[model samples]
Target: MSFRIVDLAETGSTNDWIADHPEDGLWVRADRQTAGRGRRARAWTSDIGNLFTSTFAAPQPGEGAAPQLSFVAANALLDTVARWVPRERLSLKWPNDLMLDGMKVAGILLEGHARGVIIGVGVNLAHFPEGTERPATSLAAAGIAPPSAREACGTLAEAFAAHRRRWREDGFAATRADWLAAAAGIGKPIVARLGNADLTGTFEGLAEDGALLLRLPDGALRPIHAGEVFTLGDQA
Candidate 1:
């Protein structure tokens, strides 16, 4: 794996850049992403102190990663954070966000094509920035203070690489177990927001393929393959 760090970048969309490069195990990171973005094309503010990165993976067919590469990326991050922060303090907030003490600290977004998968990650290292619609957080604010951006990236990248290698061996079942160990709301009452409709249930953890197991109010455990779920927050 090779890493290329640029001081600044025009766009936060790593999937776009990796698509053109397609270099095996290539990583692109920018301290400032002028048009940093998130899921649904929301504005992702990339300040000089934050960590914004995108990585490319040479594709493999019949692997658990084809349609659900995001889970793999999330698991890698969870593993990485667990090494630096206590498991109790670090939690995988469903699909992709890495939450610490109930505030979002990092996020992963994956885009794929016939050739490979592009994994984009944004981390708030310094200030979480005010004026966001959702509550946000940062590593420095969460007691992992004074850590350099380069140091955090190096640690996270190492963890991600190991986690990803294991994922290729064990598939999503193994990934599900690893993710559950670090998830925040497991076994707790959680609400799944599905835009117009919402499902209230207890977080029963994850299924074999990474779908959520929500024990609904009716006491029936439902398998939810799609929907944003979190504690107290309405899914959108």
Candidate 2:
């Protein structure tokens, strides 16, 4: 399906734009976002030269749950970035982050809207935020020339559509498999901050339904549906 893409010089947030517009197959990409944010409502550094875009995903019957779209988006973003950067330098972090060389390079946010789900994506093209909780990197930082925001959005839109189709046709089984293959930190020790508590365990993989599979010290596998994940670097 063709997307009605709106390229803006600036916006408060692409996700919020889609939230208000709610048009199926509509996409909003901004050169700069005045109020961009990631999961848990953390402020996102939306400077020019980065890719800030959001697209609406109309509800589809028999498709995986809305939250599972996070993986779909992650796969798409991974493909998009790999177009410019070496694939081996990239990996998808649990929940909604794309890691480049163990530092965050991209983030995905799926927000439920009245019409469907709004998949917001932010990629560090030429710049990344400094003094953040976790280390961040960008395409330029890795010594690769970054794509223009518009160009990156075009690639992302195509990748997202393709991945979404796979999710609808092949089901979450295939999508889950693809995500796991490129997932970061599998079998590595990490910490998950769960609001009132923090759990440190080995990153096993993802559960059948997209929950994180964390192996506790006792060897019991725990399914984490929601929480902020901190890699060993972040803990250090």
Candidate 3:
């Protein structure tokens, strides 16, 4: 599908703009966001020179669950960032986060709208917030010249379109395979924080439907439908 880009000097949040205008194939980009947020409504620092963009795509039948789109976004993000930096330096964190040298440099937030789902992506192009819950880094911090927000957004749209088409045609199996190949800390000990409780397990892999497969101490695999996953030290 073709995308129409709307470049905004400033906005409350690119995702919010996309939410308001739920047009299929519409890309909303902002130089900076006043009220940017990540998963679970966590505030995202939208410093200028970073890339904050969101796109609206109508849901389709037989396209798998809405949550699986996170994988699609993650794959596209990996491709987008690889254009500048070495692909080996980038890895995908669970759900929808892009890591640079083991630090989070980008994130994807998927929200359901009236028309479909609004996917908001934030990339630390030239700047990254300090003292975040987890460590963060940017392309510039990695010693690579970062692309402009507009340039990055354009590349993102193209990559997103390609992955989305693959999703529509090839289904989640193909996307899941690629995601696992670039996944970080697989087979390592990790903790999945499910709000009030934390479950320790091994990062086995992903289920057929994209649920995180957490191997427990009892030799059973628990499919995590939703939670905050973090790789832990050798304590599991």
Candidate 4:
């Protein structure tokens, strides 16, 4: 069973709430998040009628890299969207950002715990904040039929459950293939913004542990651990 709330405001982040006020699977929806966040503390819009969801899972033992959870979560979002859109059109950006026709449709953030993992996912299901130069998308804007917030979150959770099971058995190799098959930019020139330092290189694809493979100008292959990467328009 899933524990859900209807009208919550901001309180730092929803993942924090799931950590302290633990539940089986808490679905926290806020009317307005004063300080909604994304990767690297970017301001996330929490406008009404959009999806602001976070799911906390009890941890399980695993052998592969721990950070593969983001891949699993990203693929889960893609899987859910495939129920409506053509799966071939879905692809994953560096990390777990979801792309459709090269524009960002949704993205995921995964937080780990001692006994469980809290995954915070924010999807632009309806609207986006204005003045944002970065391209943003919505489910309805993308031609997907509208559904209630509860229904959308439930659908993603169901899809995530199935992908999580595959992550347990198949390892990152299988995860990378699934993501690459639907990738928007596989081999192309792109710029990687890793904070601290930025590198421009050719986007080769994903490594075994989910890191992006970048072939620099020197003909040297670089494996990026985690960074904000932008695939050129051509790649997209």
Residues 65-172 of candidate 2 have per-residue lDDT tens digits of 888899999999999999998899999988999999989999998888877899999999999999988889999998999988989999998998899899999999
Better of 1 and 4 by TM-score: 1
lDDT of 3 by residue, 93-203 (tens): 998999999999999999988678999999999999998888899999999999999999999999999999899899999999989999998999999989889999899
Clashing pairs in 3: none
Q: What TM-score does prediction 1 earn?
A: 0.88
lDDT per residue for candidate 1 within 76-175, as digits (tens), equals: 7766666667778877887789988888888887777567777888888786877775678887787776356666667666766766666777777776
TM-score of each: 0.88, 0.97, 0.97, 0.87
Error of 2 at 66 (Å): 0.8
Which candidate comes out best when scored by lDDT?
A: 3
lDDT of 4: 0.74
Model 1 regions lying over 4 Å from their true place: 1-12, 233-236
Query: What shift in Å separates residue 135 of candidate 3 from its native position after superposition?
Result: 0.8
Q: Which prediction has more favorable TM-score, 2 or 4?
A: 2
Better of 1 and 3 by TM-score: 3
3 or 4, which is superior by lDDT? 3
List candidate 4 stretches off by more than 4 Å.
1-12, 23-27, 233-236
What lDDT score belongs to each candidate, Candidate 1 first? 0.73, 0.91, 0.92, 0.74
Q: Lowest-scoring 10 consecutive residues by lDDT in candidate 3?
A: 227-236
